[model samples]
Target: MCYAKKLNFKLKTCTTLSRVNALSSVAVKFAAYLCTIDSPDIANDYLKVQSLQEIAALIGTTSRHLNRVLQKWTEQQIISRTDDMIHIKDWQAIQEISEDIRFV
Candidate 1:
Protein backbone atom coordinates (compact mmCIF):
# COMPACT_ATOMS: atom_id res chain seq x y z
CA MET A 1 0.00 0.00 0.00
CA CYS A 2 1.02 3.61 -0.57
CA TYR A 3 2.13 5.56 2.51
CA ALA A 4 -1.09 7.54 2.64
CA LYS A 5 -3.20 4.41 2.20
CA LYS A 6 -1.23 2.62 4.90
CA LEU A 7 -1.73 5.53 7.27
CA ASN A 8 -5.45 5.59 6.56
CA PHE A 9 -5.74 1.87 7.23
CA LYS A 10 -3.82 2.24 10.47
CA LEU A 11 -6.07 5.12 11.51
CA LYS A 12 -9.19 3.10 10.79
CA THR A 13 -7.83 0.14 12.70
CA CYS A 14 -6.99 2.35 15.67
CA THR A 15 -10.46 3.90 15.64
CA THR A 16 -12.12 0.48 15.58
CA LEU A 17 -9.98 -0.76 18.44
CA SER A 18 -10.71 2.35 20.44
CA ARG A 19 -14.42 1.87 19.97
CA VAL A 20 -14.21 -1.75 21.09
CA ASN A 21 -12.13 -0.78 24.09
CA ALA A 22 -14.60 1.94 25.01
CA LEU A 23 -17.56 -0.41 24.81
CA SER A 24 -15.78 -2.92 27.04
CA SER A 25 -14.89 -0.13 29.43
CA VAL A 26 -18.51 0.85 29.75
CA ALA A 27 -19.41 -2.66 30.92
CA VAL A 28 -16.51 -2.76 33.33
CA LYS A 29 -17.37 0.65 34.71
CA PHE A 30 -20.96 -0.33 35.16
CA ALA A 31 -19.95 -3.48 36.99
CA ALA A 32 -17.53 -1.46 39.08
CA TYR A 33 -20.31 0.94 39.97
CA LEU A 34 -22.48 -1.91 41.15
CA CYS A 35 -19.69 -3.53 43.14
CA THR A 36 -18.82 -0.18 44.65
CA ILE A 37 -22.31 0.51 45.92
CA ASP A 38 -23.09 -2.94 47.31
CA SER A 39 -21.07 -3.36 50.45
CA PRO A 40 -20.59 -6.58 52.31
CA ASP A 41 -20.03 -4.60 55.47
CA ILE A 42 -23.58 -3.34 55.22
CA ALA A 43 -24.91 -6.71 54.04
CA ASN A 44 -26.31 -5.00 50.98
CA ASP A 45 -25.85 -6.49 47.55
CA TYR A 46 -28.73 -4.67 45.90
CA LEU A 47 -28.05 -1.71 43.68
CA LYS A 48 -29.45 1.56 45.00
CA VAL A 49 -29.83 3.13 41.56
CA GLN A 50 -33.31 3.96 40.41
CA SER A 51 -33.37 2.29 37.00
CA LEU A 52 -31.31 0.52 34.39
CA GLN A 53 -32.04 3.41 32.04
CA GLU A 54 -30.37 5.79 34.47
CA ILE A 55 -27.35 3.53 34.84
CA ALA A 56 -27.16 3.08 31.08
CA ALA A 57 -27.19 6.84 30.61
CA LEU A 58 -24.52 7.26 33.25
CA ILE A 59 -22.35 4.70 31.44
CA GLY A 60 -23.07 6.18 28.00
CA THR A 61 -24.72 2.99 26.76
CA THR A 62 -28.26 2.08 25.77
CA SER A 63 -30.53 0.49 28.33
CA ARG A 64 -31.07 -2.48 26.06
CA HIS A 65 -27.35 -3.11 25.92
CA LEU A 66 -27.11 -2.81 29.68
CA ASN A 67 -29.94 -5.26 30.09
CA ARG A 68 -28.22 -7.72 27.80
CA VAL A 69 -25.04 -7.47 29.81
CA LEU A 70 -27.04 -7.99 32.97
CA GLN A 71 -28.61 -11.06 31.46
CA LYS A 72 -25.22 -12.47 30.65
CA TRP A 73 -24.06 -11.79 34.17
CA THR A 74 -27.14 -13.45 35.54
CA GLU A 75 -26.46 -16.55 33.48
CA GLN A 76 -22.94 -16.58 34.86
CA GLN A 77 -24.35 -16.40 38.39
CA ILE A 78 -22.66 -13.07 38.93
CA ILE A 79 -25.83 -11.25 39.72
CA SER A 80 -29.56 -11.55 40.19
CA ARG A 81 -32.31 -9.12 39.29
CA THR A 82 -35.74 -8.61 40.82
CA ASP A 83 -37.91 -5.95 39.30
CA ASP A 84 -35.65 -2.90 39.10
CA MET A 85 -33.10 -3.97 41.63
CA ILE A 86 -29.85 -5.82 40.88
CA HIS A 87 -28.20 -7.94 43.51
CA ILE A 88 -24.51 -8.74 43.18
CA LYS A 89 -24.05 -12.44 43.86
CA ASP A 90 -20.35 -12.62 43.04
CA TRP A 91 -18.78 -9.44 44.25
CA GLN A 92 -15.28 -10.84 43.95
CA ALA A 93 -15.87 -11.91 40.38
CA ILE A 94 -17.28 -8.50 39.52
CA GLN A 95 -14.39 -6.76 41.21
CA GLU A 96 -12.01 -8.92 39.23
CA ILE A 97 -13.87 -8.12 36.06
CA SER A 98 -13.75 -4.44 36.91
CA GLU A 99 -9.94 -4.74 37.16
CA ASP A 100 -8.31 -1.45 38.11
CA ILE A 101 -11.49 0.51 37.59
CA ARG A 102 -12.82 1.44 41.01
CA PHE A 103 -15.63 3.69 42.06
CA VAL A 104 -14.99 6.81 44.10
Candidate 2:
Protein backbone atom coordinates (compact mmCIF):
# COMPACT_ATOMS: atom_id res chain seq x y z
CA MET A 1 0.00 0.00 0.00
CA CYS A 2 1.11 3.56 -0.54
CA TYR A 3 2.18 5.61 2.50
CA ALA A 4 -0.80 7.95 2.41
CA LYS A 5 -3.27 5.07 2.02
CA LYS A 6 -2.21 3.59 5.38
CA LEU A 7 -2.84 6.63 7.51
CA ASN A 8 -5.71 6.83 10.01
CA PHE A 9 -5.82 10.59 9.59
CA LYS A 10 -7.18 12.67 6.78
CA LEU A 11 -4.68 14.65 4.71
CA LYS A 12 -6.38 17.89 5.75
CA THR A 13 -5.98 16.97 9.40
CA CYS A 14 -2.35 16.19 8.87
CA THR A 15 -1.75 19.47 7.13
CA THR A 16 -3.44 21.38 9.93
CA LEU A 17 -1.38 19.49 12.48
CA SER A 18 1.80 20.36 10.66
CA ARG A 19 0.88 24.00 10.46
CA VAL A 20 -0.14 24.27 14.11
CA ASN A 21 2.98 22.53 15.34
CA ALA A 22 5.19 24.71 13.21
CA LEU A 23 3.43 27.87 14.31
CA SER A 24 3.36 26.90 17.97
CA SER A 25 7.04 26.15 17.97
CA VAL A 26 7.70 29.64 16.76
CA ALA A 27 4.93 31.38 18.64
CA VAL A 28 6.71 31.75 21.94
CA LYS A 29 9.45 33.71 20.32
CA PHE A 30 7.01 35.64 18.19
CA ALA A 31 4.66 36.47 21.04
CA ALA A 32 7.51 37.79 23.09
CA TYR A 33 8.60 39.92 20.19
CA LEU A 34 5.13 41.30 19.83
CA CYS A 35 5.00 42.30 23.46
CA THR A 36 8.06 44.45 23.05
CA ILE A 37 6.32 46.59 20.51
CA ASP A 38 4.16 49.42 21.82
CA SER A 39 1.03 48.30 19.99
CA PRO A 40 -0.25 45.09 18.42
CA ASP A 41 -1.24 46.98 15.29
CA ILE A 42 2.38 47.86 14.67
CA ALA A 43 3.11 44.24 13.91
CA ASN A 44 1.21 44.67 10.68
CA ASP A 45 3.72 47.22 9.55
CA TYR A 46 6.53 44.76 9.96
CA LEU A 47 4.65 42.12 8.05
CA LYS A 48 3.78 44.57 5.32
CA VAL A 49 7.29 45.32 4.14
CA GLN A 50 8.45 41.74 3.88
CA SER A 51 7.53 39.69 0.88
CA LEU A 52 6.22 36.23 1.65
CA GLN A 53 9.61 34.91 0.58
CA GLU A 54 11.40 37.17 3.00
CA ILE A 55 9.02 36.36 5.83
CA ALA A 56 9.38 32.65 5.16
CA ALA A 57 13.15 32.93 5.26
CA LEU A 58 12.94 34.77 8.54
CA ILE A 59 10.67 32.09 9.96
CA GLY A 60 12.64 29.17 8.48
CA THR A 61 9.78 27.98 6.30
CA THR A 62 8.93 27.76 2.63
CA SER A 63 7.12 30.76 1.21
CA ARG A 64 4.43 28.61 -0.40
CA HIS A 65 3.66 26.73 2.78
CA LEU A 66 3.70 29.83 4.92
CA ASN A 67 1.41 31.60 2.51
CA ARG A 68 -1.06 28.73 2.64
CA VAL A 69 -0.98 28.69 6.43
CA LEU A 70 -1.49 32.41 6.58
CA GLN A 71 -4.39 32.19 4.18
CA LYS A 72 -5.98 29.49 6.28
CA TRP A 73 -5.56 31.58 9.41
CA THR A 74 -7.03 34.54 7.60
CA GLU A 75 -10.08 32.53 6.65
CA GLN A 76 -10.44 31.48 10.25
CA GLN A 77 -10.27 35.09 11.46
CA ILE A 78 -7.13 34.54 13.45
CA ILE A 79 -5.51 37.12 11.27
CA SER A 80 -6.40 39.61 8.61
CA ARG A 81 -4.37 40.07 5.45
CA THR A 82 -4.26 42.96 3.07
CA ASP A 83 -2.20 43.48 -0.03
CA ASP A 84 0.84 44.48 2.02
CA MET A 85 -0.13 43.87 5.61
CA ILE A 86 -1.01 41.08 7.99
CA HIS A 87 -2.87 41.92 11.17
CA ILE A 88 -3.33 39.61 14.07
CA LYS A 89 -7.06 39.75 14.77
CA ASP A 90 -7.29 37.82 17.99
CA TRP A 91 -4.46 37.86 20.43
CA GLN A 92 -6.19 35.61 22.96
CA ALA A 93 -6.89 32.99 20.35
CA ILE A 94 -3.39 33.26 19.01
CA GLN A 95 -2.00 32.87 22.50
CA GLU A 96 -4.16 29.86 23.13
CA ILE A 97 -3.10 28.16 19.94
CA SER A 98 0.50 29.08 20.49
CA GLU A 99 0.69 27.77 24.01
CA ASP A 100 -1.47 24.70 23.68
CA ILE A 101 0.28 21.88 21.93
CA ARG A 102 -2.83 19.73 22.13
CA PHE A 103 -4.97 22.21 20.24
CA VAL A 104 -6.90 20.82 17.23
**What's the lDDT for residue 64 in model 2?**
74
> Compared with the true structure, what per-residue lDDT tens digits does model 2 show for residues 39-65?
444433332223767545444557777
Q: What tens digits encode model 1's per-residue C-alpha lDDT throughout 1-104?
A: 59996686556434433443464666686776666666454432322347788667655689988888899999999989998777889878888887645333
Q: Which runs of model 1 end up more than 4 angstroms from their true locations?
A: 1-24, 39-48
Query: Which whole-number lDDT from 0 to 100 does residue 80 have in model 1?
Result: 93
Candidates' lDDT values, in order?
0.67, 0.52
Model 2 Cα shift for residue 77 (angstroms): 0.8
Question: Candidate 2: where are CA atoms >4 Å away?
Answer: 1-49, 100-104
Poorest 10 consecutive residues by lDDT, candidate 2 = 41-50
Residue pairs whose backbone atoms clash in candidate 2: none
TM-score of each: 0.63, 0.48
